[model samples]
Target: MQIRDLPYADPGRPDVRSGPRFLYWLGRNQLGGQLRSLFWGVVHSGSVALFPLAVGMGVAAVVDRSGARLAAAGGLLLLLGALTALGDTMLHRTAVTNWITAAARVQQLLARKTAELGSALTRRVAAGEVVAVSTGDVEKIGWFVEALSRFVAAAFTTLVVCVALLVYQPALGAVVAAGVPLMALAVLPLLPPATKRADEQREKAGRATELASDTVAGLRVLRGIGGEELFLSRYRSASQEVRRAAVRSARMWALIAAVQVVLPGLLMIAVVWYGALLARDGRIGVGELVTVYGVVTFLLFPLRQFEEIAMAYSFSRPSAQRAAKVLALRRTAVPADDVEAVAGDLKGDLYDPATGLLARSGELTAVVVGDPDAAGRLADRLGGHAAEGAGDSPSVLLGGVALDEVPLDVARTAVLVQDKDPVLLSGTLTELLDVPSSGAVTADAALTAARCDDVLASLAQASPDGSGDPLRTRITERGRSLSGGQRQRLTLARSLVTDPEVLVLDEPTSAVDSHTEARVADGVRALRAGRTTVVFSSSPLLLDRADRVVFLREGTVAAVGAHEDLVRSNPVYRAVVTRQTDEEPDKELVESGKSEPIGESA
Candidate 1:
């Protein structure tokens, strides 16, 4: 088939597959090209078998004292030899191209599936498995695709040589025809076990790859908690387990190799023994026997490809399964709706069923969630980044329209949630703030609102991207080179630039000091005038900025009122603000409520 005809097959096409099926489909994908290559390969194989005869013929003609005629025959033999070489080159080139194309097609399918899955992919498949599929399995898929034509060509080549010998001299021909079957059949019995072990080895390798990826991604956190050595030990154990599985697999393949060697040796013995009888009986010419021997010798190499194809299948099958699993993943969190408009303006309030909290529009609301886990889930749900059914997940609504029902891009454009720990990409200060749907804001207004004028000054001092200009300088990966507060302020500035209809701030001021956080709260409230803003924080400074503050008990709103009103009426709200506990006297807790937990003490 033409490259254009390599239709997009489902990435999940392969099952707990054997390698042959994968190649079968791969060959099916490019049948036209492969069929042509197979025809050419056969022609080349036939030429290869005949070229040996030209040498023997020239030698015999010289021995028979027909030098002039033999010399002319010699020129003809040389020309045939050159043509044979050219055919072999074309056959090999086409076969390799077929392999690469097949691999590329599978890779394209895998990429499409990955895009469809997004972040949900890692949850379903190990990172290492994904890596292994891309690295090793892809090549194997190609091998199977490219091997089909060669296998076909090789089979016919064996047959063609067998017929040529029979026509040239029956005695020698019979020996080759009979012996070649023995060589091929010998490996058949050993195949089942060989393939099984190869598959086992491949699986163990994939697991090992997954383990390594997990260990690396969390290495920093493990070190921070003094668990680095423990994780290292676990990874070492995993590595050893993979090693053992690999060794067992290697043993099985080695046994197959032994069969491969022994079977061909016996075939050679049978052929030589029969040929000796033919030569002594004068039933076959010495040159005819020599050519037959040469053909069989060449045939052995292609037969070995059968072993290679089996091995390639063993490696590729597991890889295809891993890729298939990734392709099967759907970003279920995003809604399927085709939104007509993102939002001219965010209407009504944001309500989360999981937490029974309502964030009213045109108001600064503080949600003091008692359950941190519930709060995080509610945050994800509120942003329409996770699925919500009933109370399975939290829900955020705009004008009573469930956030989950809105199109992803529409939801994103409407509600911008700044998570507690936000990611800062590497780029110029201007580029970093250039997240989707955000553009040149009155940078001064956003900066003044996020209280990031200091960060801008720092960038101006020494730009990481070499511009020494805050708008042009690039940050390092994860903003690792920046301080915690600097990164938080930068992310806030980016969010402010988007100027979404509703802004969700989850502990946006956690990294900064109280005075700076207080300033930021005022700036945000002022900048978000006439817009919806929800801040999740217990800081009295941030709470004071809210037009309404809701105290959460268990997972429901215990009280909803102004910050000062809630403090007077709700004991939980008072205790949280004053950092007081039940262990403290109720009178003291109720009085100032400043007895509540101190900064970072919660």
Candidate 2:
């Protein structure tokens, strides 16, 4: 693939079995580019290897005082120079292409995986770890793949140079050949220690990154609770640990580098010492001895490629493993094999078999549960979240077809589940509301439906959009700049704008005041008059407005009726919705001039 073609049209499924396997997959994906790099690498190194041969011939011609031999030697030197320049230039270009394409391929895989898993991706892996992998880890993996071809070329050139020397002058050639392998093998024992150090460094760095990400995400909360210093201190400690691990890793690598330097120098000395003896014994000419010395010195350059390749592999292995781990995560299964296609145009009831909760089409249903975790799980099941390790997953059906069986894109288009703690992405207000256009809801209408007029007024204190509208105001990441209630309202507005056939909101107004919560309940009901809406909440304000309220006990639906009837007849429902107990009977309701009618407004 061409470098310009980047981000493959079909990045294709990756082989994420292991670190090495993933790297092999990357190489396989861009086979043509890799081969080009390999060819250029061989040509360049081979040209470099011919340098000493030209030098040897030139010295012999000078010694023999032969004009023709000298001219031929000069011509050979010029040819070697041209080849080296051309090959080296092209090799650098191809190697860079390999690096970019490999990195692009990995980035595409990560993006695809993120889209496939959605929010569940972070639940399975740390958000910071995901960030680290997509950024620095990808570059390291690319570096290893790019360096592999150069390493192969270097090995080939070394072998060819050694054999050429042996054929030209046997005595010195034997000594030079033996020294090269010894120098290359000297550092094998150090590799294990270096690899361990690198792994430690990566682990510490990932921890530091995680700590930093969490701290930043919750900075506003930390400030509110006066715990900012505690988090800062923890981050400082994590940073120091990363520093220590990095230094340890660097020290091991430095030792390896020193070995590379020292051993190559010693090998050069051996070749010169042995070559002098061969020249003295009259077994080889002085010019040939000079050529052998020059050849051995030049060998040191290619030998360094081995050191570089080892270092690259050491750094990249852990990164590849982390990338593979993320790629292996699968979302809830889509049971396509056991089911046939269902008519997408037919709107039907949403049924959760595990909880026996059925929300009919065109109804506003509120689920009230004493346990928030159970409520959350029901909401997740309704949204088709795949729970782990189940041979037959509990399915949520829409239009008689399991939601899990429906294509992910179609399922998502039909049902949108807003989490209890919804995130408001950072952008101008207009950009934040700019979801894909569907149905008939506009941003203004959605904002009104979610009761965000006050939010707009608050934002209008700053400069408004060109139309003098606060809808264009900038929102910080996760809407951290806004109050909890305002962020909740804004998130609700965004969800409304999508206007999906079914909107499943999990405690969407938990942070808002009772009055604002009542308003949101009214707005949602008015806007979603004929669409199925499921709100998981036990708040009296929301429950009172829902057409039907399902009371959940333990894990299953225990009662289903109008909010007033259930509160008056069911003790468990009254205790949950009114926050009543034997000792206290919801003082907020009692003091608000509302007496013991269970569903009375507080």
Candidate 3:
């Protein structure tokens, strides 16, 4: 099947849809697997379920006719048994292929979604939830999809056996045929509750996964505050909640299992009771009674399968809906399609109507504010992370194009934003700089700009299992293997490689030493000459090299001048940048009971 044909989130679809419709969609896509298994299912089920009944009929014929009939019936049973074995083998092979295809299609959708959303994806979805969906959820979904066809094939085989029984004795045939439906329908009432319970369990499980992920991600930080026990206690509570939810779900499923067994047995008993009465009245012969009983036994297989189909679907529906929600998140903004069709030097005039701030093109703009939250949100909008109220909210612009109007892919490739706390993905020194883009620049150039020329020398191409070198090496997840400064520098270096038209760096040199920070500032100015660059730092070294600095008073632009000009002309801006707020009296702080820090921390 083609990748595009697989179901993604179709948010527009109505909710009144049914399980049969879902089955049909899956079945339509399962042609290859079905075709491979169909003949086998037909042969194997027909032989295994139908042959015994057919033999019972033949045995009745032989008993009436003696030794002659017995010889012919024996030969026929052997032939049917061999056919059943062949069909059994083929059916298994085909069903597995079907399961695999369905799984592959879901994986493709997930991969495409991850690419479409980029950095914004993790912001919207938990890493552990995504991981669980890829491994466990996909398998569950594939199973439900594949089960549809086999379920139908089993039901159809049962129908054929019932018809054969009817031809032999109409009274028993009608009873057996009618009873199968009643047996299957008994479980229908239990399905909705089962699915509801399953959905609850799934949610609890996802929450538990998120809790563990959060704790592990902040493990070092948690230890620093001695809050590890607090978090561990919270996690323990969450795990207990999940376990309780799981038990409730298991109970419902158990009831379903109990119904599956009891209902079919009741149907078998009814057939036996009625068939005996007919034989006693001389309306049906003994051999016909045997065939009737055999046919009812054969019908049990499909009846059981019908119950399984109900159970499979009840669990899969909610997962599919959850997956759809993730796929349905609209992009933060819809940028104009006409982004110059090419890359060029972007004059760094940034305007955000939402915050009433503007940084003119071709200058280093330092946005100083008392509110860091406002700054970060504004940064996300500029970095192409989809904003929540972006539709009605005002936007930041670059090169006279509203940031929201720029397509995500183009905006991401063109404007790079390095957050203050950037993460370095694990890999060789080369790969770390190549994140969000391929390794397009020479390793030496990126390292020079990020000031990681020395850090690279300390690492080697190594593997856990040994023996591997290809100019590529895998790094540990989240750069846990590297030091904090090392990770930050590597991230800055990689962001530099793209050499975007606009570089909005939010404290890029925060983790490095003063000397390394100075070098990074010099390297940044040199590497970004003629390009629009904005570095969000209060460091004097970064400020000294700026072509211009726009001082922000609150959210609005209060004054615009060179770094020295702003320092001399604007009192509040100077006091804020130079950490002069501490000079204020302790009586003023105690009287107000609240105070604002001049240089805000993100």
Candidate 4:
């Protein structure tokens, strides 16, 4: 395919069995581009190799004192120069295109895998490692893929030149041919050490990258806890380790480079010295000796390609492996043959047998768990995601069908889970709210329900152009420019716009003020009326609005009743919702409507 037709309709399933296999798969997919690059490379190398011959012929013609022959030699030289320029230009163009397209294909595959895995990807793989693979590793892989064709062309031209020299001038050609191979093979002993050093450097760099990502993601928390200095020192040490490893790797590659240069220089000196002796002894003509010298010198260029290819392969091997590892990740291990499709119109209660938590159909259920970790796990299980390291597949069922057994697309469409810390991707306000929906709610309605009018107003006021339209305002990456409450509301609105059959939100209003949280609770209740909505929270404002509240102690359900009933009857439930110690007497916090605000304790 042409470069313009890139971003393949499908990058096709990659062979992720191994790193080498993945690299091979990438090459096979781009065979057409490789062939085109190879053709141009051959043209360029062939034209360059013929230059020395043209010069030798010109010298011979000048010596013969024949004007006609000199004129013919000059014309040949001019033609060769033009062909060299044309071939070299096309060769470079095609090679760069091959590199870009290969990198693009790899990036596309990674993106697809990420979308398939969703949040589970970060759990299986480090966020920093993913970032490194997508950025630096992709470029390294592309370098190796594009280098292969050029190396082949260079090797082919070198072989043909050696054979031609051997036939035309046996005495000098023998020395040239024999020394050429020695020059190419001289650096073989150093490749292993160089590759090893490179791998070490890559490993260190990945760790450093991961550390930096973690530091930045939790920078605010670190600042609040006065732990920023501790993390910074830790990251500094990691950065130094990476620097040292890089130096070690560079030294090894430099040694290999020195060998490549020294061997080629020695071969050129031998050819020039021996050819001069032959010419002096009447064994070869001056014209022939010049040709031998020029040919040996020109051969050095192609010989260097060997060293380049070796270096490229050493660096790219590890990169391809990392990419393969990420691509091999699976969200769930359900076999393709075992998948069963769910009816499009199916709707029922969402149940998780692992914890005996159930949300009846067409009801608002609030789940209160004493342990935050257990609450998070329940949220995941509610959406059919098994807890990490769990032995069996998630037993969460909807409409009498196991979620793991049903197709992933169907499972996701049936249940939407918004975690405690939902991320807001950077984009215009309009683009952020545009997502797959059931045609039941409009963007404006969702925004209003989530109480995001203030968020929009602030964004518009901050706009450089002073545009009052909030939809035209832009958000920074991860919504770092916005406050926690603003980001949470925007995320909530995006989730609301989807209008999924079952919506599970974990502490959706944890970042907002009491007034905003109360309004959000009401907005959610009104918007999600008659729909299966499961909220995992202990906020009195939110719990009071729930039609039914299920309380959990040590994972299993301990009590189920209305918010007021549980507060007065269940002491454990009261302690969790009121944020009070069990030994502390409950003063009926929910009843008095004097619940502590989020991030505060009694």
Error of 2 at 266 (Å): 2.6
* Between candidates 2 and 3, the TM-score winner: 2
The model with the greatest lDDT is 4
lDDT of 2 by residue, 267-321 (tens): 8888888778878888888789878888888888888999999999988888999
Q: Is candidate 3 or candidate 4 better by TM-score?
A: 4
Clashes of each: 13, 0, 7, 0
| All candidates in order of TM-score, best leading | 4, 2, 3, 1
lDDT of each: 0.72, 0.83, 0.70, 0.85
> What digit string (tens of lDDT, one per residue) describes model 4 on residues 1-602?
66898878988999999999999999998899889888888888888888888888889889988788888888988998888899899888888888999999999999988776666677778898999999999999999998999998999999999999999899989998898888888888889999999999888899999999999989999999999999999999999999999999999888888888888888888888888888889999888988888888888788788989999999999999999999887554456655443545448987777667779998999999988877887887787664233445456888777765555566788899999988888888899988888989999999999999899889888776776788878899999999999999999999999999999999999999999999999998999999999999999999999988888777677777789987776766777898888666345554555543221110
List, residue by residue over 95-200, the lDDT tens digit for candidate 1: 8878777777778777876654334345456788888878788887777667767777878877877787788777767777787777777766766776677677
- State the TM-score for model 2: 0.82
Model 1: residues with Cα > 4 Å off, grouped in runs: 1-47, 59-63, 68-116, 146-149, 163-175, 178-182, 332-411, 414-417, 438-442, 461-482, 501-504, 529-538, 547-602
Winner of 2 and 4 under TM-score: 4
TM-score of 3: 0.81
Model 3's alpha-carbon lDDT is 0.70
RMSD of each: 6.2, 5.5, 5.7, 5.9
Which wins on TM-score, candidate 1 or candidate 3? 3
